[model samples]
Target: MRRASSLIAYAIACCLGWPAQAQDYPAHPIRIIVPTQAGGVSDILSRTFANKVQNATGATVVVENRTGANGVLAADYVAKSTPDGYTVYLGFQGTQSVLPHVEPKLPYDPTRDFAPVVLLATGPAVLVVHPSMPARSVKELVELAKAKPGAYSYASAGFGTTHHLAAEMFKLAAGVDLTGVTYRGAAPANQDVIAGHVPIEFDNLGLAVNNIRSGAVRPLAITAKDRSPLLPDVPTMAEAGYPSVIAQSWFAFFVPAKTPRPAIDWLNRQANEVFSDPAMRDQFLRQGLVLPLGSPEFLGQHVAEETQRWGEVIRKAKITLPN
Candidate 1:
């Protein structure tokens, strides 16, 4: 009888301690994992957010880069990590939305293996062409491509990247035929375009800003709903007569599934606080990013919708990865 009474007391104590433990979460340093090589947009964004988190919480936040298999390595690492809120992921559209449709046998299920924490920011891509191409605007480019199908080629970061998909979308929307050239990364792809080897390409504005300003590459249209302040002269894709080609890359925060709800809520509150600051919003804007605020559930819904949208596009374009 005494042993039974002691067992009941212990169970009640555990139930009470959970909330207290969650309230005192982050008693130690936290790590944010970036699923790409250092110096890329993902790495830069992760580091910047980590700094803000550290400033707000006074906790040591470390940003770690684990690049391989197009962000699969770092994502899988975080997915299988302990659900203690100490380890988090800075997931992007490619890993969370595009990979599942392209890689038939992805090791980790993006939807099932991770829980959404917050949506960070989104950035649009710019349709840039080498100055030697002679087509100065989006309409002229489409007309030129229609006149000489397959004569012009476009470059992208890789076969199944957002850059590649955006170009494919443009081809379908404009009813033009242009060959696609794949590169190991965006830097090389952009370099080849700047060198005039590749006539055209779609790249993130942040990556192509300097080149655009330097007159190395000409910006025709931005794949966004509205024109960006950085390039006030560039028109939106919709205004360029290709409303269906709109695409924007997004970043968000995630933790391993089954993480305590209180911990997730705490993390979400911290993120909202950091991004709500005027300075942080301006910093992101200066980097060509637009911050969109939302709760965790909102992020999950957004991911689901994006995955469905991209899946349809991939199917129509017949995009797939080799085994």
Candidate 2:
């Protein structure tokens, strides 16, 4: 009898245009899971947004690092967590788009397991070479790699990452035979390039910006349609005669599928409010990220498009990772 009474009360509340949970949403602290290690661009960006959201909503937002399996672990954890608004995942290009193509047995489906929240930011990968290397431009690098024919090598975050795929695309377009050296993450891969251990690498602009400015590594070209404002003098891959070699990494937010509509709407509004701030815009821009805020539907469409695009690249390149 009591359970029936409670259901009747909830129905009455809904009929009156009031939902109790939505009205008092986010009543407790929220937790965000970052799938990568601390100090990388993704980690920094996730923490920055988390801080902004906490300040805006006056709710505790805790960021937890659950790094492993190229972000599969964290993504799976969030996908299986409660559908309440409290648990969120920072979804990136690898987990959302790339892995589905390269890894045949992903534990969670990108499209089916999560609800899109918002598209946060996007940035092109920068092709940088050690100062000790002879190449000064993208064309020169291609020529050098052709001349050596597998003598020169490039580094990547790991197999199936954007960094790896970007290098593969460059190889196919430029018709070069450069070997790829894999690392656990971008930081270590970039570190080898900066230390002159690796001759070349394709890294996110945000991670390579400081080193580029310091002359620790020389940037050949950015993998975007246009040159980034942060590196205005650098030409794009298209300008370097490889028009098909364009690639960029993007970040978004997601919650488990079947989450309440009102909770999702509230989270979207909060994200838009935080990203629309002038200060936040400038901060992201300085780090070589372009903030392109859009609706959840827009993010869903972007994810689908990117998955198809990268899947083709992976198939053509014959890219695969170990199980």
* Residue 131 lDDT in candidate 1: 89
For candidate 1, what is the lDDT?
Answer: 0.88
**Which candidate achieves the best TM-score against the true structure?**
1
- Which residue segments of model 1 deviate by more than 4 Å? 1-15
* Estimated TM-score for each candidate: 0.92, 0.89
State the RMSD for candidate 2.
3.2
Give per-residue CA lDDT, model 2, range 193-219, as digits (tens): 888888999998988899999999999
Q: Candidate 2: deviation at residue 153, Å? A: 0.9
Task: Report the error of model 1 at residue 285, Å.
Answer: 2.0
Error of 2 at 109 (Å): 0.7
lDDT by residue for model 1 (1-323), tens: 99999999999998899889987887888899998778876787678777987887787889998888888998999999999898999998889999999887788899999999999888889999998988989999988999988999999988767689899989888989999999988889998999999999999888888999999999999999999999999999999888888788899999999888888888788888878889988878877888886899999998998898788888988888844
Which parts of model 2 are misplaced by more than 4 Å?
A: 1-20
